[model samples]
Target: MVLKESLLELLKIKAIANITIKELCERADINRSTFYSHYSDQYELLTSIEDEVLDELQNTLQLYNHSDKNETFEMLQRIFEYMASKKDICQMLLSDYGGRNFQNRVMSITHQYIIQKWEDEQNILKSHSEYVTLFVLSGSIEVVKSWLSNGMEDSPEAMARWINDFTSNGLSCIPKNENSRLK
Candidate 1:
């Protein structure tokens, strides 16, 4: 716990990639040996931060029931807000440590969000559910990544509306033939 606090302090000072164990130890008031005892390197330290963040996020997300599709919007906004809270860490994670793995993790989270909701609702459990899940997950991530990349110009509330609108329109576009069951 102390080490993590020191690491976060160093992260506030500079980029994660540039933070050496020696500096972390100094900031943390621990010896080099203690730093080594805790983590392998800076990458490991960042990974630990990621793990902690994910744990918190999961807990926060679990609080919301799955049946509410609107929670999807709220969740993403919450995540963005979390990132926004840690501006320096966000800069480092999004710029350096984060990449395809990050994107996959995000898509997986989005999928879980919807699947849980779908199960609770018991409304769309077909095998083709994967299609819809992937569609929403990927598209939503793309929108988020774009928002982050664009300096988060739009507030999260606005972004959620953008997503809700885009998704609702796509749902409306299913043709009459595909809607045969509805009739």
Candidate 2:
């Protein structure tokens, strides 16, 4: 646990490629042998952390059936709540330093869910489903990144509602301001 926490902390400041085992060991307050016994290298340790999060995300996705709109929204809220609960690790892993692999993995986990939801609720064409899914997932990822970067002042429920509204209702769901450029 200490090693994983230490690696995540280091990731906040530097890329995984630049982080060395010695530094990680020092940060974790353990010797090189201890780290080596658990992970052969920094990348392995990082992968371990990513896998843990991915597993939990997959499990979370399973908790909701997505059979209805309300259930879908609840699932999204639950995901955001999970992210909030693991703020530090989520923030770091979703950041630039964390690399696209983790983000891609996350998208992969949620891809089927999003695709099924759109197909059932929106009646989206099968041929266009991939594009639509990509667009929504990309936007949702950016929203999560922004939410994490902003210290998550809003509650998870609020974030989930905004995301759901934006995706389901499009731009109309977002209120316009006179000073805003959307108009």
Q: Count the backbone clashes (under 3 Å) in each candidate.
A: 1, 0
lDDT of 1 by residue, 1-183 (tens): 777777666655566667788877887888898788878997787688667666766776787754555776676567667766765445545443343444566567657866766755767765667787788777776666567767878887777666765665675644468547666
Error at 110, model 1, angstroms: 3.6
lDDT of 2 by residue, 24-100 (tens): 99998999999898898998898999998888888878888664667778988988999999999999999889888
* Candidate 2 Cα outliers beyond 4 Å, as residue runs: 120-123, 178-183
What is candidate 1's CA lDDT for residue 103?
A: 56
TM-scores, one per candidate: 0.65, 0.91
Output the lDDT of residue 163, model 1. 71
In terms of lDDT, the poorest run of 10 residues in model 1 is 92-101
Q: Candidate 2, 165: how far from true, in Å?
A: 1.2
What lDDT, from 0 to 1, does candidate 2 have? 0.88
Q: Candidate 1 versus the native: TM-score?
A: 0.65
Whole-model lDDT per candidate: 0.67, 0.88
